[model samples]
Target: MSGNRLYLSVSLLLSVGYFWLGWSLMQPEPKHNFTPCLFKNVTGIACPSCGTTRSVLLITKGHLQEAALTNPLGLLAAIIMLTLPAWLLYDFFRREKTFYNNYSIAERFINKNKKIIIPITVSLMLGNWIWNICKGL
Candidate 1:
């Protein structure tokens, strides 16, 4: 898809996700485990993203330390979820494509540096998975 459409679609999806998160928080916690992770369900092992939801919830509640302890990726996710929509909307209203342009630049950089970037990304994910397992997430 084109950059504008991609941005708009992502922004809307993220907004809806945030709204669902908020709504879930308002309800009472479920009695049984209702995790959304199929990998975890089948394997009985915490995936790299196991605690991300709890981490993001803690982040929304302003518990930065807890959120980080839960999952460092949540901090990154929170930053993107919180800021991206506003930036996308701003660009959309102004008929600008700065975010898309930057995204393209980043994509090109990552593609060019894949030999370096891919290994690092994989290592980080593996590290996170190890951390999650150790923490019994």
Candidate 2:
């Protein structure tokens, strides 16, 4: 297969894996062994993306409150998990990369709003970090 098709196939596989993970975690007792987050293990603190897997599984199983409690990013991730495969499949069949073509717009927006964007980004990140710390995750 061509490079684009190869990438799409890999993407599909990853999506399926994540979905399977979510399904497995939904069980009364998860049978899989989980590796602790490396950052959390070394630092004694939850990393920005820590709890993401649990959160995704929770959200997929319709446990939104639990998902948010696990990780705020989980909500965003769930949305992406739901959408990205369809997006990739659409692009694959079209034989064009629509997702990659939108970068210039984002770049222009960032360049125009750096002063406003930087502080907001920092605040959100710091706030989320504090929340994670408070949760003792």
Candidate 3:
């Protein structure tokens, strides 16, 4: 069936992607003191994605306050980035041939709350950023 092929394809792609990502992470990352932000030339305000790497680095160094100062959202983003690949792999593996044919209630939550959830997530991130900036002062 088409669904089965789709599942298999996704699994294969995720497997390859996970392999590449692990390989890349094992290698040494670049050292750049200057921060990079696309909005630097435009609005001059650091975009929402700015300071992401600094936040990640700070988090890894166990500097929670510094990580949050750099970007609270970025720290959360880093957590998601770290877990997403594993989640994708899990999902990919389970999707095959109806391996997880009966989806759980938790999985059903995704389709049930999109309208309210999205705006709430945006508001929470914005609030977190504002709180972080205020806390820095």
Number of the top candidate by TM-score? 1
Give the whole-model CA lDDT for all candidates, comma-separated.
0.88, 0.75, 0.60
RMSD of each: 1.5, 4.5, 5.8
What's the distance in Å from true for residue 44, model 2?
0.9
User: What lDDT does model 3 reach?
Assistant: 0.60
Query: If the candidates were sorted by their lDDT against the true structure, best first, what order would they fall in?
Result: 1, 2, 3
User: Tens digit of lDDT per residue, candidate 2, span 31-132?
Assistant: 654436787777778777777777888776799999999889888877877777777777778887765454456777998999999999888878888888
Candidate 2 TM-score, C-alpha based: 0.72
Q: For model 3, where is the 10-residue window of minimal lDDT? A: 97-106
Best candidate per lDDT, number?
Answer: 1
Identify the runs in model 3 with alpha carbons over 4 angstroms from their true place: 1-34, 85-108, 128-137
The sequence of per-residue lDDT tens digits that candidate 1 reaches over residues 1-137 is 69858786887789787887788688786798777889999999999998887888898789999999999999988888878888887888999998888888999999999999999999999999999999988
Q: Which stretches of candidate 1 lie over 4 Å from their true place?
A: none
